[model samples]
Target chain A: MSAISIQQIVKTFPGKHSVVALDHVDLLVESGELFGIIGPDGAGKTTLFRIIATLLLADEGTATLRGMDVVRDYKKIRKVIGYMPGKFSLYQDLTVEENIQFFATLFLTSLEENYDLIKDIYVQLEPFKDRKAGKLSGGMKQKLALCCALIHRPDVLLLDEPTTGVDPVSRKEFWEMLGRLKTSGMTIVVSTPYMDEAVLCDRIALMQTGKILQTDTPQGIIDSYALQLLAIGGDHLYDTLQLLRHFEGTANCFAFGDKLHLSLKDNSYSAASVTAYLEKNGRTDTTVEPIQPGIEDCFMAYL
Target chain B: MRVLLFLLVKEFQQIFRNPAIIRIIFIMPAVQLLVLPLAADYEVKNVYITVVDNDHSSYSHALVNKLVASDYFVLTGYADSYAQAMLDIEQDRSDLIIEIPGQFERTLVREDKATVSIAANAVNGAKGGIGASYAASLIQDFNTDIRTDWLQLPRYNPYPVIAITGSNWYNLHMRYDLFMVPGILVILLTMVGSFLASINIVYEKEVGTIEQINVSPIRKYQFILGKLIPFWIIGFVVLTIGLVISRVAYGIIPEGSFGLIYLFAAVYLLAFLGIGLLLSTYADTQQQAMFISFFLMMIFILMGGLYTSIDSMPEWAQVIAHLNPVTYFIEVMRMVVMKGSTFADIRSQFFIISGMAVFFNVWAVLNYRKRN
Candidate 1:
């Protein structure tokens, strides 16, 4: 059996226009596996996490954690799953140690009982234990929130965009902490908008506009691209993007950093042929070469 | 029970940490209790009077002295004509006018009949009516004095008289602060209990900490109780401070038992705090909570019979006053403090408040949903 299973879940927010937040979303994760939900803002990632956390009821379908139904067995589910929301939800007026102890007492356990589970992250937050949660830096606040959520040592952990605003060094340290937690046999499910973090997960679901475009391992998602790709580098990049969009037999072209990744319908056109064509169009400075695709390249391909 | 204890600890810590809340809780009652009773006095004094003495006899001079001596009236000055006195009334300088008719002493000596015309500016109805009554009673005293002197001459017979005497009950001397202080204490207790409890939960919602609590395993009743007990205790502290101020400042001690007051206050706090928590459940922000609480409190306090007598209100307004929880507590405070009413006297108020506590708390608990 899977650690988490969601079937045909649909949620809509009633308003003047009535936004459909999730549309027939289905997913599954095996035990002890690190799953990632990769999407941009407003892509229903938070909505999905809220449903599994039992804080929301789906309009249509069912979700379960380890075979317990979300709505029917919510009381049981709440005891076994640790959910950290996207917003900083701990009491800001409380000190870091008080915030953690408060949650521990609510869960009917003390910090000394589950010290081993949160030891790795709590050590990083020890220096600021007496400081108010609101007074800490952005990264320290997230770390304290994580420690509060992990104090009970639940089997399933759901983190919603935990690293959205952290500095680069803290973001790296947070992932390493999660990596250690995962090896202890906890089923960790996380979400992020950064494509680079998606590579660290065991499996990822690519989502956009309340729908999942693809779900697979990082290597498998990259290998599924069937078109020949080329990178075009030159001065006047915006002009080059426009020129490549209008070029004959060009199937897709997207700006990726300094280079433009382009795909062609006909494989017969080589890098030398494309460069010769650009030179003929009064473009003096240009270079073209074939290259491999990354996860963002696959996401843009799907879009 | 342990969960409730922890929750209470967190609530007390947060409440004491905020300087603004500390000031509101401890200092506001002292300032308002000291200032409001002094300012809210209803005894009418210093009514400006303009006398038009057309009769320049010794009798007229005596009447002017009598009117000026009464504390209720301040003589603006004597006007030569009634028309000139009317000018003072028009300019808002004088509130009442007494016109002494011509031949005032001659008529009283011969036919024993005299008339003095009094015209008052009735724009301020209370001041005008009370001033006119005061002037009329003083003149009656002077007439009796002259008739007594005539009776001593043995020419005029003294008529048989029947005098009516009355006594003021519950508040002798008719001190207004005695009436106002107890009522103001009720208002202060209600504001502290209901307003603070209403805003407490909504602040958590606005800051998104409610979502964390909702996702936890805490039951709905436990959460609502945790929010309720702290303010419930604070309500008693405010009531105690108010009682002390009334005693030390105005020399007031409750004629009834202290146990009865606390018994009534304990149930009253539950009912009002339940109302506040009910409002918190329906509101998403502290501003929304405050506005809803304000709207209800305006109706509650105004119709609560603190500023005006409930018996004097229109029948429809009387129904609203009876329905207000604040009205019952204010009445209980007055009955216990002023009238020395015992437990048997306030039996109905006690049961009604208990019912309201159950009604509002049940509604609040049912309305506070853990999942949405």
Candidate 2:
């Protein structure tokens, strides 16, 4: 059985005009699996996580964690789930040690009882354990928040965009920590807007406008993009792109870094033929190469 | 219950670790309780006066002697004219002036009653009134003495049949501090618990820390309770310190049970914590929270009878005071401390505070939205 099963969940907020934050969203997380929700800002990632965490009730549909209904068994689910929110939500006035100990105590446990589970991250905060949580550096505060979330030895961990504002090094370190936690047979569901981080997850769901567009393994999604893609570059790249759009059999072309990534209806067109055509149209120093579709490419294809 | 205990401990740690908060929580109360009361008294003393004795007779000298004999007034300067006395009044060097007419003793002998003019500055109305009354009484006493000596009759004491037996309960001297200390402690506790609690939580929301706690398994109630319990305890500790200072500095002790006072304080603290929670739900920034709480606190304290008697206010205001938890707490505290009332004596106030606590908690929990 899946550790978490969300079936056609829907939530709407009442206002002058109703805001449809979640619409018929469904997800399933297997035990001991690392799942990721990939989307940009306002994509309902946090809303979905909150509903599953039992922090909010879905306006429609059923969500269950380990066979316990989110709404009916909220108190029971609270004990088994560890959630780290998108923002740093620890008590600012409390010290680092105080924050962790408070969370542990809330769960009817002590820090010593679950020290082994969080010791790796908690140890780094030992020097500044007495400092107010508000005064800690961003990275230290992040670590402390994660430690507090994990201090209760929860079964399912829900991290809502945990690395949104941290430095790259801290971001990388945080993922590594998640990986270590995953090996301990804990189910992890994380959300992020960074496509690069999508590759680190065992599986990912691409979401947009409160709807899940696709859910699959990162490689599976990329492998499923059947169109031939080519990276094209030349002088007057803008002019080249305009000319390429008018070319026969051209499907789609958009700027990708320093090169233009193009999808074509036919693969029979030769690179020399494209270069000759660009040169004929007053372009120079053009280069073209065939490239494999990445997760970003797959995301663009869906968009 | 375990969660509450953990949260309380965490709060104590936060309050105790910071030296600034420690100073505010512990030392500030002592200063307010000890020093502010002594400075706040309205009892008048050490009055200064300038005498323009036009007669310069033994009779005028005798009247001046009577005035100087009283501790209330001291002869500061001898003014040559009314203009000089006006200078003394403007400079605050003297509060009163006595102008004795020429031939004062001869006029009194012929007219039976001679007019002695007295001018006083009435800027501080209460003080001015007291000083004027003292001067009038002194002159009247002298006139009566002269009448008695001239007539060769025993002194006629008016109101001889009337007797006043004065007794000050709880506070024998009615030290202003005794009346003020408990009220000050109540205000401090409300400021620390409600004002600070709301600011702490709302600050997290403003800084985006609330999002972190929201995603955690920590329930919303747990988070709020965790934030409030520490402040509540700190407020109580501050109250205890204030109480000790009142005892040491003002020699005022509770006439009622100390345990009962603390019990009422705990209920009042919970109501205050609920108010803080409700404020957190409404505010998004610390400054906004502080200002809003400060405004509401002002209203609560004004109607709470911290400075004035609520009974003296309009009936509508008295009804509003019934809804104010601070009002009941202050009333209950004063009764226990000053009147030495037992539990049964304050049951009505206890019921009102208990009802308010329940109402505030429900309101706080209901108004607190998890998703926004």
lDDT of 1 at A138: 88
Q: Write the per-residue lDDT of candidate 1 for residues B1-372, one digit (tens) a residue.
A: 999999999999899898888888778888888899889877879989999888899999998898888888898988989999999999999999999988988887788889998898899998899888888999999888787776766554567677888788998898888888988888888887789999999999999898889888988888988999999998998889888988999999999999999999999999999999899989999999999989988999899998899999999999999999989989999999999999999999999999999999999888999988
Please report the candidate that would top DockQ against the real structure.
1
Summed backbone clashes in each candidate are 0, 3
Structural similarity to truth (TM-score) of each candidate: 0.95, 0.79
Interface RMSD of 1: 0.6
Model 1 chain A poorest 10 in a row by lDDT: A264-273
Q: For candidate 2, lDDT tens digit of each residue in B54-104?
A: 888988999999999998899998888888898999998888889998899
What is the DockQ for all candidates, taken in turn? Answer: 0.83, 0.36
**Cα RMSD to the true fold for all candidates:** 2.3, 4.9
Best by lDDT: 1
Which stretches in model 1 have alpha-carbon errors above 4 Å? A265-277, B55-57, B78-91, B99-119, B142-157
As for candidate 2, its clashing pairs are A88-B209, A89-B209, A89-B213
What is the DockQ score, from 0 to 1, of model 1?
Answer: 0.83
Whole-model Cα lDDT of every candidate shown, in order: 0.90, 0.84
